[model samples]
Target: MLIDEAYKSRILRGEKTTTIRFGEYEAKPGSEVYLVITPSDTAVAKVRITNVERKKVKELTNQDAKKDGFKDVKELVKALNKIYGELHGEDEVTVIEFEVVEKFESGIPLKWLKGLNYRNPEEIAKLYIENNLKDSPDVDLIIRKVYSEGLKEAVRRYGPKRVRDALLKAYHKLYADGKI
Candidate 1:
């Protein structure tokens, strides 16, 4: 499960307990989910799903938004539309409730890269694969990294949602090349 910085912090701090996804989520109630902080594939914690509820976007209550670290339902809806495009109040959504079980120091530590200790992009790509993408069937580590790393400037210029779209596009390309 990927989350943005704010929600990630809230989850770590034990403030946020519920997450609202815009559509269907296949995980069972008792399944474990590795929470990865987004714009980067950094696994920060592990959580166990306690419940899953499906409802229309309009059905989200202020209480639900509060559990998600938002001030109210309106705030949650606005943020959702910004990230996932315009959504009507009646749009279907999945509400997931989870509890953190464990945390990690550095899921994908970039300190070595910052210190110029890595061999090459390919090696780093492989390292990423070993750490996070091993079980993912159609995601190319290298291509994903290319977009993620390459979009730093764009992320700074445009922001996370757009950059995330670019990264997803890159990953989709990998599927076509049979490298996923």
Candidate 2:
């Protein structure tokens, strides 16, 4: 779900719970989706869709506008017009209601390692090793073991504490270096 940067604060503060899209939107009820800020495409939070309703523009009310973080229907319409060009009252729109599940302190860059699939710590460690520590001794052997035995098995073989420490180190390094 792409949202304007202007609404980032509202979303994070729980002021905005519903979004009125110009046309049919794919978000389904009870589905979890990432809230990505537009233009930057930074993943800021995860949300669960609570409801979805389709309605004509003319049916939009002050309540709808309020849920969308607008002062009134007129304000909402104007903003919608600015985003989707001219819209008639007869035009259909989709209303998506959602609740924030998790918000990130530092948003994940969608382009970074393909968003690192929402940044699993172990996965980050594996990729970090592959990309930054490939020349280190035992790198190849560890990589092979991880691929063949999976992360849990690798953790057992290498000691859980060591694997956890490596994962934490990799995560912090990536975060500190702005690679996450």
Candidate 3:
């Protein structure tokens, strides 16, 4: 994921050109530089920018870059971060915890949860799907909404500890149902 020093050069003093690419990437050139976006969606596709030396990479004006004392990339990046302190701030993002309040079959909520919410949405959703997929595929419709990618995103947003705890609870439920 890091292109690093593998693609950098000062073509003409004070200006630099950096060529970047990954495996199976297309090559392109332009008045400036061409950025190629991959076509596939499910593969976490990669893109490549080739032949940058023949072109000059664009630079921001001093007035634009230094408005907040941002002299370079590091300063600009630091300034972009609005966080000072606190677990999360106004501009910061937090993982929202989702719970299953109850189960449903044929659009009717069940008392299976005993009025308690499950900490893990995936576990609850998985169980609901597994149970419903037997009688009616309609009840399992929400399963697709809870994708592996979505659950992984939740794992990334929340720490591994929380994700693992939820996963364990889900596993326990699966075990109880003899579906593990």
Q: Which one wins on lDDT?
A: 2
| TM-score of every prediction relative to native | 0.59, 0.67, 0.22
Stretches of candidate 2 above 4 Å error?
113-115, 118-180
Candidate 2 residue lDDT tens string, 110-141 = 55425344564345756665566442344444
> How do the residues 1-180 of candidate 3 rate in per-residue lDDT, one tens digit apiece?
112221112221213223222112333432222111123111111223323222111232343334323466444334334333322122322111111122211111112122214223455556645654332342233333443444546445664455444444454555577764
- For residues 130-157, write the lDDT of model 1, one tens digit per residue: 4444324333533355435543444455
lDDT of each: 0.65, 0.76, 0.32
Arranged by lDDT, best first: 2, 1, 3
Model 3 TM-score (2 dp): 0.22
What does each candidate score in C-alpha RMSD?
A: 11.8, 10.5, 18.5
Over 4 Å off, model 3:
1-128, 132-151
1 or 3, greater by lDDT: 1
Clashes of each: 0, 0, 0
Q: Which ten residues in a row have the lowest lDDT in candidate 2?
A: 133-142
Query: What shift in Å separates residue 32 of candidate 3 from its native position after superposition?
Result: 49
Off by over 4 Å in 1: 108-180
